[model samples]
Target chain A: MIVDSLPRTTLTEIAGMAGGGAALPALAARLNIVEMTQAAEDAVLQPKDAGRWPHALRAALAARIARQNDCPALADRYAGMAGADMAVADPAVAGEAEGLTLVCRFMDKVSVSPRDVAARDILELQEAGVSDADIVRLCELNAFVSYQVRVIAGLRLMAESVA
Target chain B: MNDVIHKFTRNVPDWRPRVTPVKLEDATPEQLDALQVTPSNTKVSAYVLTLAHDVETLKVRSPLFNGIMYDPGGLDRAARELSALAASVLSRCVYCAAVHAARHAQLSKSTEVTDDLFANGDKADLTPRDRAIFDLAYGLAGSPPAATPDQMRAARDAGLSDAEIVDAILSSALFGWANRLMHVLGDPVRKGAA
Candidate 1:
């Protein structure tokens, strides 16, 4: 929730100022990162993935982790995706709940104490039927989210300094 | 202080990765595109290739990353490398720590400086400007993240411009993520090993 307390006008101005000049290149790079983040989220929640994991369930897990990490913005974003009416009845969630939860647990661990992630953690995912491909994707998402948190934190710090 | 830095001093890898990488031939189209081909057709490092498992993210990651770490403006190469090393060392990612440590040495042209930093960052022999940068980098790498306001003051007092400070933030922050990725993805092994 790094963006939560900021004025919408100021943010718009920041976005606007990024349109041209020396800032343009950096802005474009940041915008691309934003798009990439969106794309990854979309891929994770896309219908094709519904068979393996429901978007809502995944979002719920993300929301829970975001809340734990004190990222109000991310928490809110994920909670919205999780939706008001949520349950584990979806076969994807019911069947692979353990695997999914483990991924969530891994995200939580990596968010703070990344060094603690042991070989056993990866092994457990494999034992639970999470394919190597899935494990890789999970790591990617976890890694990206961890990056996102710091990036946002840094940006917020920058913004606060200017403000 | 010595306990904080990575213990590896020599026998670093020549061109080998610590972990099993996704071979280029096995890469997806997106992953293939993630490779940064130079005039001679060289590509990104083995570490990046291993990240091909998620090319959608890598595409954006590459550009933002290049801009922050390798772009020609803002903090000088040595200072940025110092920021990178500070973060990598504290994060305890031996792979990235070594890369940046070597780069810092090469750019600064002082092996002893790099050695001092790796041995004990806080006590590293540094100029006033370098000390300021290190303070911020170490602060950012702290568990709860050192106080931003104070670090900013220290940087400004040490004579860094806003843009330079931004570079410091970006350099250190990128490694915050990078180190975690290396730690989770695979191990960093010594060269000539089975």
Candidate 2:
């Protein structure tokens, strides 16, 4: 919900999805990694695991993190999707108390500083009605976002030098 | 088969994470298949079993991991492992750090670099070439904002081909996220309980 859009060029617009950097091989590599990322997101956010974690919840949590990380493009898309299903976002609209609050809280830890998280922190999620499977999915989603944000940001940096 | 098959153990238990992984007896058929063997057809390890708690995601995760680490087109296994170690070091993930460090030493057969890296990655004994991976990956993993073109240039200066550098970024970024998951899912123990 707090995800604000920032103006920028998307990788696809810049390089036809794989955006070239200085070298052909480097460009290929970035494109390959980006393709994997796109595929992974489609798998996670689409119809596959709907029974466990809804697409909406995934969107909300994803948007929250993209916002936290300053990924405007990703934040805008996921936040828009999350808007419909946020039946009861926290007072801060930050995903508290709702089963998602637990996800948001934990993932926020993951986003800011993962080293500080302890077993007790995970237990709080379990107590909040998140199953072990859901917990794993949350971790997967959060971690993937971390990877995605960094890769894109780094690639964006590489893209700037593109001709 | 991956060496992790033989190396899996809960020995280095940390009291920090408390989620119980699905043990062998409780594993599902899907997990049974997944935990049964490594890519090389050797017996799988407790690590796979532990991950069986969420077999579906593991189904999705393992192949990607294999592609990045074991796929044909990227950095050699040693350089890939080096990138992983750099990220794990940044995440301060003991479990992953231990696993990848051993792999780096085995693949490179260069104990001095591996040991120095493990001891203090901030200043490993690598030449500018090898050091490029550390520079690029540390910033990439710790804080993407901190990562800059210089890190990539540094990797290039160290004599890594563009593809190698790409692999370096991919592997390091993978661990940046992965280390976080491992940290929350469970803590690493030095040895399994006897």
Candidate 3:
């Protein structure tokens, strides 16, 4: 929806620029995005998480995501992976493009019609007895920030227990 | 609503509210005044970081959400107003809903869309773009599991970019947090109901 409303040429140009493929290696090297990605996958998939490996790995990922403003496409790839679709449902290269396209559409709609109730959401969590500080900390979770609405809501629940 | 409600129950073992539903005429001016404010306890930092992400989303990723938060060059103001409207309604925050409803009227040369957003939640007759946004708001506010691959694909078919989609998701997530805060603090004051 948001995508449809945007200038097609702009989307094309952006896609083309990203597809030039120069940024991937740079991104992979700069943040160890590739290694981090692997580590994250292992941490999530393996047992005995006990919150150690996952915590360290997430901290690493969060750092990279914080710098997402510099290279949105790369950020898009990583954030998108973390957000909704982690990898192409189909293994084909075209599937990745299609997946990216789907992510783009979803993001456009959200960006356009964002929820402006940060104050209220926090209050609800706190009214439920979550602490003010913990509420703030939960909001810092990049997964919650990047489109994981359930994760955000879950964070509120998690915060309630800790707070 | 039930899931969020359940989440609260599971999290707060000792939490109990000081509920006091005052009648309109009996309510103190202070209570009514507080309704208009975002509240000191509301997490401002969370709001700021999410807004910053939204700015980056628009500037580098997609034009759809580029100017929603701030507008120097003036772009997407109407759409932003629409977003604000959707955000408030889904949030069920009386204060935010009223404010953004007025904003939608001021920005648009019409009131039909705003009216729809008020009367209907995600079922409003909006453009494909706004519709997608509405869907996101509902998912973010109510049940996020509803944001399945189908929902994602619908937006994609409608032409959204990866950047824009991520922005939208972040925005929805941000507001979801915001709405919960507002609701927990207190309901908003109606235009002149107090």
**Best prediction by TM-score:** 2
- Model 1: per-residue lDDT, tens digit, B1-194? 11222364522443333335668767766667767544577566666776665565566666766767777767888898888877776777776778888888888788876787777757888888888888788667654455377666767788876667767876786776677677666666545431
True contacts kept of each: 0.25, 0.50, 0.06
Residue-level lDDT of model 2, residues B76-154, one tens digit each, is 8988887888887777777787678778778887667767775665876687877877778788886434677777767
lDDT of 3 at A34: 24
Error of model 2, residue B182, in angstroms: 1.4
DockQ-better candidate, 1 vs 3: 1
Q: CA shift at B117, candidate 3, in angstroms?
A: 1.9
In what order do the candidates fall by TM-score, top score first? Answer: 2, 1, 3
Indicate whether candidate 2 or candidate 3 has the larger DockQ.
Answer: 2
lDDT per residue as tens, model 3, B6-95: 111101122122122233344235433322224464332222322222221212222222222342322245554454455556645554
TM-score of chain B of 2: 0.79
Q: Per model, how many backbone clashes are there?
A: 2, 10, 33
What DockQ does every candidate get? 0.27, 0.43, 0.07
- Evaluate chain B of model 1: give its TM-score: 0.84
The per-prediction i-RMS, to one decimal, reads 3.8, 2.5, 14.2
Better of 1 and 3 by TM-score: 1
Query: lDDT tens digits, residues A1-163, model 2?
Result: 2212221233343322333335445545444444556666665565365556788877777776666676767776776776666542222465444635566667788876887777778788778777776677777777877777776665665555333
Error (Å) of candidate 2 at residue B152 is 2.1
Off by over 4 Å in 2: A1-35, A85-93, A97-99, B1-17, B23-46
Question: What's the candidate order when arranged by decreasing lDDT?
Answer: 2, 1, 3
